[model samples]
Target: MPRSQPAIPICPPFPISGILRAARRRSDLSQRELARAAKVSAATVGRSESGTILPSINTFATLLAAAGFFLAVVDPDGNVLQPMKTRDDLRDGAERLYPAHLDVIPDPEPGEWWADIYGLARPPETFYRDRRRRDYQRRLSQWQVRVSKHRHLPEPRLHHYRDAP
Candidate 1:
């Protein structure tokens, strides 16, 4: 018998321009029509469909909505990714579980990118549950001392030394 190889999952390519054009065409809408319905300039729609410019998610969603289409985050096999809003999905066969307070969407700090999404909401960068808090503090303090001393003489000379003119 011949040996069979396991199938590897292939990632689906997201061709923005092609998708936009196809969706628009499917609705029989021209760039101008799509733009008008989306409340954007015709040039923007044309550029997006032609691949000359990349449209923001907001604008793209607007256009898709106008064309009776929708923008959805999907995985390789077209499975919708994270489709449920944390606030709305409370025990609707969800795979992830969290306490009520922690279940809702969290507000990210200013200049911070999607804090909760990146796990930044849990703790500071230096914190890890496996490491003892005291040990981490000691190491951090030592690091600070080394960093501060680094700007000073790399090596101190106890022997007599003179600066040359």
Candidate 2:
């Protein structure tokens, strides 16, 4: 028998279609114009406005940003979770609230670039030298361990000594 699964609580549906249409009209952009501005397909925008499908989060944000607006999270009681009036305000809020953490970057590509810079890629010479040093040190430690383990035993007579009369 199949195992019983826990019920997933249903989230209240957001009126994404209506919002998309209203925002686009307020921005004075046709569906095609908004699509072009947001770098998404025109058909996708049309479909989203028609409620046939919801656009991806990225698409939604792109479209809204094109209209000088953005999305914000709110608590279950409808209180804004991270309220801010502008991009700079958001930056200030994060800096004040989470000082030790990194600054929030709006662009996605730079985050990936930072990941590469962090550890995945390195300067060629430095990486090669560090890798070689680590390998040599590891091998030296292993050899020392092997030698210590057998240090108490007498050396076996060399089988290659043919003239040992």
- Per residue, candidate 1 scores C-alpha lDDT tens digits across 53-123 of 99899988888899999877776778987754453333323544444322222332443333445554332
Q: Count clashing pairs, candidate 1.
A: 0
Tens digits of lDDT, candidate 2, 1-165:
343567875787899999998999888999999988888889999999999987889889898997777998866678987643344334332344323223343333432333455655421111112333344455555555777875665543322224332
Candidate 2, run of 10 with poorest lDDT? 122-131
Query: Positional deviation of 110 in candidate 2, in angstroms?
Result: 40
List CA RMSD, all candidates: 20.5, 21.5
Least accurate stretch of 10 residues (summed lDDT) in model 1? Answer: 123-132
* lDDT for each candidate structure: 0.63, 0.64
Candidate achieving the largest lDDT: 2
Could you tally the backbone clashes for each prediction?
A: 0, 0
